[model samples]
Target: MFPKAHQYVNIHAHRLAISQDEWVLTNLFAGDDFPGANETAYYSTGLHPWHIKDADSEQLIKKVELAAENLKVLAIGETGLDKLIQTPLDLQLQVFGAQVEIAERRGLAVIIHAVRSYNELIEFAKVHQPAAAMIIHGFNGSFQIAEDLMKAGYYLSFGHRLLISDKLKDVVTHIPAEKIFLETDESEHGIRELYKVVSELRNISLESLKVMIGENVKQVLRIR
Candidate 1:
């Protein structure tokens, strides 16, 4: 979650954070400026689409390639299709497709963005057939869409919306532990609070669920 919303990272028994929360928080949209190595402490990289507009696409591509070479850059993207935004759909698709291609080449997992463009996103997935497992973050789609993606062997990430949706609870009930994750996304809800609800819904202790999530992060990110 972002500081502008909840305004703080409330660390608790929730260890779903494979790395420190602020590390994931601050650099979430740092884009090509995202760390390759850190002197303070190491942080993981998550490629985001929002910042793509600010940089030269060609230069960013090479920067991302270099970032991918770093062991710390674990995820290929928060990149994908979004139809609701003001940005041109064509450019979004170009950046999205390019990142997917680079991810496939680098053996990195992806954090995806899919807003009002599931059909197009699914089609891109068909062509890319990315080797990295993708986690569709902030998933608020219908049960059928979630089921469709699940069947495609992609993991799903949940965030603030889970605090509201009963339908999501039902959908979550059917998903296996290995494929399930909880994220703050751009939401204010603390990760600890998320675990409280998720642990209850999944019928597992908060500690156990956190462990499962940590393992999922490791497997998906291919982190040592």
Candidate 2:
């Protein structure tokens, strides 16, 4: 039998300063410096759309390929289309596509950062049909978009926005528990606080919500 979910899981955090006992997935930019050598937190590496200008496209792809081989790396993004960012959409698509290919090849999940480009993303997913699980992190889109992605077999991860976005709370309450996840995503809010908000929103106990998300994490990361 699988172990029961007992701790908060932060799917995407810029810093690794959270409590030691919680399960966290930290983000590492492909072109940036690696995390501290002594840090033992699990990580997800990709070429963030905002940082593409600072990296050599070819070399960054290679680095992401190499990083995916590490056992400590659980997923392959924080990478995806961001319409609001200055990076060109075509370039972002190229980078995001390459990372998706790498995640599929490496048997790791992906965490996407989509902004105002859900149609393009959904189209890409339809064409590529990537085998690895794909999660849209920091999701705050309309319920129709959420429903579309979930129907397409993509997971939607909500973050601090749930605390204030009534629309997001409605989405959380209606979406299947198996198709959702929660995160802090660089917010000042603690995972425990997010958990409390989500529990109340979903009308479920905090422990039950933890177990539900924990199971999703295990499946996405292919944890044993």
Can you write out model 1's per-residue Cα lDDT over 1-224, one digit (the tens) per residue?
Answer: 12222122221111224434332422344343555364332233444556667357667766777777766666666677778777788888888777777777877777777888777767766776767777787788878888778777678887788889998887777788888877776565777777788879889886677677766655666542
Those runs of model 1 whose alpha carbons end farther than 4 Å from true positions after fitting are 1-27, 30-32, 36-47, 52-55
Give per-model TM-scores.
0.80, 0.93
Query: What's the C-alpha lDDT at position 172 in model 1?
Result: 78
lDDT of 1 at 10: 22
Candidate 2 on 1-224: residue-level lDDT in tens? 12246778788888774665477788888976665434567789998888786358778888989888777777898899999988789989998998999999888999999899888888998988889899999999889999999877799998999889999988988999998887888899888888898888789998898899888877888642
Model 1 scores a TM of 0.80
lDDT of each: 0.65, 0.84
> Residue pairs in steric clash, candidate 2?
none
Instruction: Give the Å error, residue 125, model 1.
Output: 1.8
